[model samples]
Target chain A: MSANWRLNVAVLYPELLNLYGDRGNARALERRCQARGIDAEITPVVIGDHWSPDDTDIILVGGGQDREQRRVQSDLHRRGAALRDYIEDDGVVLAVCGGFQLFGQHYRGWDGEIMEGIAIFDAVAAHPGPSIQRCVGNVVAIWEGETVVGFENHGGRTYLNEGQQAFASVVSGFGNNGGDGLEGARRRNAFGTYLHGAVLPKNPRLADRLIALALQRRYGSDAPALSPLDDRAALRAHAEALRAAFSPAESAIGRRFA
Target chain B: MRSLGSGGTALPGLVVERLHDGAAGALAGQLSATALITGTNGKTTSAAMLARILRADDRAVIHNRSGSNLMRGVTASLVEAASLLGTLPRRTTAVFEADEAALSAIAAAAPPSVAVFTNLMRDQLDRYGEIETIARRWTEALGGFPGDATLALNIDDPLIASLESQWSGSSVRYGIEDPDVPPAPEGEIMDAVWDPETQDEFRYTRRYFAQLGRWHTDAGARRPVPQVAADQIDNAEQGVSFTLRFPAGERTLSLPAEGLYSVYNALAAAAAATALGVPPDTICSALESHQAAFGRQEDLLVNQRRVRVLLGKNPSGLNQALRTLQAPGERHHLLILLNDGVADGVDVSWIWDVDWESQAPHCRSVVVGGDRAADMALRLEYAGFPAPRAEVTRDTGEALSRALSGVPEHEQLVILPTYTAMLEVRQRFGRMGASRLWDVA
Candidate 1:
């Protein structure tokens, strides 16, 4: 692919899935790509709208609530074929929280309500019994040898099927669930995790990795060399978030910056 | 019923709950009448507006006036209003603004005569689940409420408007009917766009920053019900003027609160007040004299600097505040505080969803302070706010000092803070012995 090729990105269900500022992941990807001198265009695929990954290189799906999740559940089933095709074609997909759950095999609520997932990743997202507590707070995950810190507020206890790789090991915060101490799932070119909000801003390395992967997939692994910008401020923010995520006292107080 | 100590708000309720968890709802159930105002935002402003109108109509009422909307807060207010004998006086009305999550407990304990459903927005994601989850819970709570209760609904928000028919109650729907913006709410994060009936997305024809929609009631599957509506909003510097349309008649009035959202709040208050038999003139005059709730567009003099405090808890509220600030006038200094406390919804990422680019143009200088001060500064810088950049202080007081020192006396300084941040900031200014919000009757 030419260096000037504008990367076509599809932000699936952006209007509905942008829970807890999960849209920041899209922003981080866009800004990072632009700063690296790569032209990128984002098209939002709202409900009832039609779009395909014909030439799209990256698809981002953020988190949503259970009701919203259910609303999109059937729609996801209809596009199950297209979703599987996109992942099979080596397209990079990033799904957060509810989005992550939907890209899996299926999600089962404690109430026996079953939401069918697209099966982009081999996993099952389940909720604890109705009265069980929710998993919420700033989180730090060990990803690619870097401490990827972000905020996670979700209730899904996603379990990866055997032979599937985990995105990031749980360092702090309830990962996929409190039991496994693991978070997110990675298979092929698709990625799913519970971290929202600061996932991109707090972890520039991971953001760059996603972008780089998209570039490599589109440009036959010979993507243009990327440039780096000063991330001192971003790193400071990440450091503080990581510290806060580990400290129960600080986490309880808030996403502490001081 | 009296200030026994320098105790914090909700302290009494917290203590009573330890002794007895059900004391609050039990005490509230005996009131002559009850009205609950609830949603993601504007509960206090709308509830206070309705409560004031009720008072003007000469109705004996005691409301949860301190902006405490939780179950415990409800219990405390009811406990306070009740006598030592555990019974309220005759003809006493209780109007309370309930937190979204607390609505179920309150509804089960003491079903209201009228419940005003305000527009829901993405707020405190770290605390509350998604907007859809909150909506589902709200629907569940309404199911548990008295069957014949009246629902005051915001039709502009497709989500809330859709609930009118789902509730087995008489409904009064209200919405912004401005010519420029549609009567229904439509924009990013609008949950009502996907029409369930059509099995397709409902594309709004009008341009709306977030407000759009028509007024209609759906009783059940394919069954339409009659409902009242509001529209033709004209926003002015002082506040907003709009025409309120009811089944019997329609009336036009100007509210003293700023922005179209505040106008929506007035309409919500009007709907609830009308259900309680308030005269149109009484509602109008009461609203004209009403003030925005504490830390919500409230004006205060802090350390000799005149400042306006506005609550910026969620993306929608912050967007509206920013839109209002984009007035075709002079630029303003800004002091923004962002906290992720439990009440504030610790998932600090929602700040990213806010349209800070539009806000950057209206801000001449900025001082960001709070638990997430650095994050705010980072966003501002990314939005391309010119340098000699925003002053970042983790300490709220130090942040206020920096902001005051930068602005001249004549200029307006807007301090936008999240929930817990607003509480602490107000406490700082309140300690100076200025007027207090609860001091009002």
Candidate 2:
């Protein structure tokens, strides 16, 4: 990338969808870029704020409570077209948990309330009610030969459309619908997942991948190859998370869900 | 029993709960009055404070002092307090700090005459689901209480204050009314920021921390005036002093605890004490001399160096602890223990929500420890602390030694540990002849 190339990231509804330390994902993105000598700027897009897709290279949306989801539902719908346009232009988007659910076609709550989504990803999430166990625990997934580890805690069982692709296949812990052995949905450069150990600080590879994608979209052929930093802490955390995901004691919750 | 990995604090209660479902209720019924304290944060400190005030009033109190606040823990404490004939003293009062998620079941079993609701914040989402859900459960549970039962509520929290309208019992509402307190910083994790019914963002007139504040919405909703309020909160290195106003009278109390959050705990306790007819002098004196609960600002001397153990289980609690550290403005040596144990919520994601960045510059040195030490180190590294400055040691005991060794002779070492990690620290201290394990009541 050009020496002056900078990445602009827009965080959507941070006031409403900032649950589970999801904002950590944005921080991870910013820090990783700065570590590689790239300038990254994050702008929060809250209610009543106007954001331009032309100035945004990446977008992040985190999870939230059900009421917060409802509170942001209408506002997200208003920004849906612009977000869809940005995605079509190959912009990088990482939507986690509630954000992931809202990136799909629609989400049907257990109480029979349906919240419309932007339809950028061909997926739908449904809550099976409080009677059914929530899909929660340490999760290890395989994404394009990379091992991604995180913590998944959500009550919604998401299913992708017939021709859509999953972001990763679950190695352990319940993901997506829990029965599908799949976690998250992916379309083009847009990604959605329930993994929220901030999902990026531990999975530096995934974070770097997202950053590289955003850089490529902004700088095209002149996009610079990213440099590597000391990831010892990240690697150790990843290993620990992976071990916890496979440990019988920690996996007991997964067993109960099964 | 230790080989089974159980602390033995809640095991007997679990056995009792399994054997006879109504045994806990029976034991609780024997007490003259029972008070159940529940919230996302401050339960232990608040309960301890209230227990002290009750004791100052010469009332015999049975309490779950082990920081195990589950129904099983409550049952266990009651069981231990009962005589072999399965009876408590005629004038005995029970004070139990209950886990927020388990409050419904515990309240159903114990039927407390006084229920204390501390402020609700985002806590242990992996275990408690959400703040709204817990608030809903608490409201529904309080509905099941007797009409004559009294409630001690925090009016600063819109969610907690809203609960009073749905209950039939009288309430003593408590809050901090100090306008001098600074507004909460941007990017701090906040719960109850928006009205669920109106969808309008709640505007804060004065915010202490998280969602504890005097607030109003555009739709005409406003925070209820607290019957018991504190003002002019002075957070000193030794403790916090505040002017407390209540129905009976007002007094300046110098509580032996740190942080504005501790002041909230004191207010909640005083409110509960007021509900129980404890005199103002007795409450102030008890609070001034109150010893903190174990791992909640519990201090000790280890290897000739002063050490303070602060338990931080969630984002809000951790934020408050970090805020306390920043208040002194002097460089601090910190040992932060991050565990993903079941008791610590299994998910360490909440660490990201804590405003560690604000305290990063204030840390002279930091040692990260616990099962998730690497994660905590990574968080600190991202918070602008030099990566090389933070030493990651997975073993809590080894980390404590390293941290203590680095502290100068006159300086103090502060340890911030999660729930299970705090227990581990206490055990290490206990082995080192620094302090006893679970000795605070």
Candidate 3:
């Protein structure tokens, strides 16, 4: 990527949103990009028509209460084509918890109402009471070659697209796929689920992979050689420690998926 | 009759006596029914609002207007409401706010005709332990409700919604549809911090900040459109005007007490009142006229200095109060006193959840008191605060006096205490003949 070209990330509905700390994902993304001389602009857009995929290199969506889910489901549908095209055109979209539900086909709200969603991700989200699973523990994503750490707290069950693959395998704890126990989703350029440790910051390998993908799309065959940032080691250590604290059993077992 | 203590001898004894005598007889006898209003956040406000609405229609509704829902507290209210002759007033309707812990005991004593659950969120962890435990307890108690009983619940709460499958009676749900109340807020530095010890605590995502705003059903549903609105927010005065919309029409309700969460309580109350067939006008008018409950948000005075006591137990409650404070540019003298037991908890690690970096920096010399005053000191030090003239006194009265000493007698002193601490602080100020509790105390 050119040094002059900064990565712009638009976090939609950060205020009127989800139950998990999904914004941590955006902050982590910004911090990672800034370390590599990339300027990241994180702007919050509420329920309005001013949002467009052109201004953003990536889109981040968070979770919220059932009342908020109902409100935003209708509001997002009003945006229609703008959001549809954004996902179809391979916009790097990161949706966490409720945001993930909104991107799917529909959400079966706690009130038993079938709220329409953006349908970018093939999933059906439903409110099934307050599930306090305390999504702690280390998750080793083989694609990243290291332990990817984050927390998950969601009550909806996600049905993945027939042909789509999960974001990661649940080496330790449950994730978006519900009782079957999957970690997240990685379909096209979209990465979505209930993992809210701002997954990118601690899991720099995933952040680097996304950045590499962004470079390949923006610069085609001319992407530059990549190297780890200086503070990457310390950051990884902190992330690993948190994951260890969350997964005392696995820390005891010394389990490594990769 | 089971005796609770010396305090129970007066009224608790009588209520227990009635429960024992009337258990078999009252079941067969014809009399008024009871309504229970519950949840982690809005139990008190909704109960009071519902009571006022029932009373407006010339109904003798008995309620714990003083905001006491514990075993002792409810017993006191019930004993006081019953006649000196030990007979519950005829044509009297019982509307009581129940703590999540006491729901099972209260449920066994008296089965409610209608139960109103506002929403569940993290509040007092040290007391309640886990949010899921509270949810399970509520569900168990709710199971005891008769098949014909009405369930007036917030469809927006995932925890409460789970009860739909268990309840045999008709369930009426409500939500908000205000164009102004944003969907929810995004994650921040605050979101990254988590305490696994208190994992059951519901972390804030986007939507409702500390229990404000209303919810609507997802798109098309058969239920009534539930919307709650806070028409005006007076931070200095600490009150809001809330409006709840039902099938009949919109009921414009006003909460004399402040805090964004109170608005949700008003909605839950209105929903329960509406289900009970209370008139919309009466529901609206009663909410506006109702006064503050004791220790919930009651104000007091120390040496004639006006002190407002706000109950802060969980992250949401503290965040709600912090959000309500005006900028220093608007108002000056505000003293914040937090108890470790009531507000902080034994862990005290969740102090990081309070946007203390913003709130602590803005407040005028906050005084740390209570069981773990030093824990508060540690939190303040980490949040970029200079040594905040700490008063390590365990006595809440001394802390109240010290915190209010600098602030002028005319200006309001914001005393944010824990549950028992608020009671203790209020009792001290009450003896001084300065606490304006119930506007009659």
Q: Which tens-of-lDDT digit does each residue in B200-314 have in candidate 3?
A: 3233233556433332223222223343323333333546655566777665555677655666677677777777778778878888888666556656555666666666766
Kindly state the fnat score of candidate 1: 0.60
List the candidate 2 regions with Cα displacement exceeding 4 Å: A255-258, B1-7, B388-394, B436-441
For candidate 3 chain A, the 10 contiguous residues with the lowest summed lDDT are A133-142
Best by DockQ: 2
Tell me the TM-score for chain B of model 1: 0.90
Write model 2 residue lDDT over B263-325, tens digit each, in one string.
Answer: 989999999989888899999999998877668887777777778888999888888888888
lDDT tens digits by residue: candidate 3, A188-216: 88877666544554556777766666656
Clash count for each candidate, listed in order shown: 7, 2, 29
Fnat, model by model in order, equals: 0.60, 0.83, 0.00
Model 3: runs farther than 4 Å from truth?
A1-258, B1-31, B65-67, B83-85, B182-185, B188-206, B210-224, B227-238, B331-335, B340-345, B437-441
What TM-score would every model get versus the actual structure?
0.89, 0.96, 0.57
What's the candidate order when arranged by decreasing TM-score?
Answer: 2, 1, 3
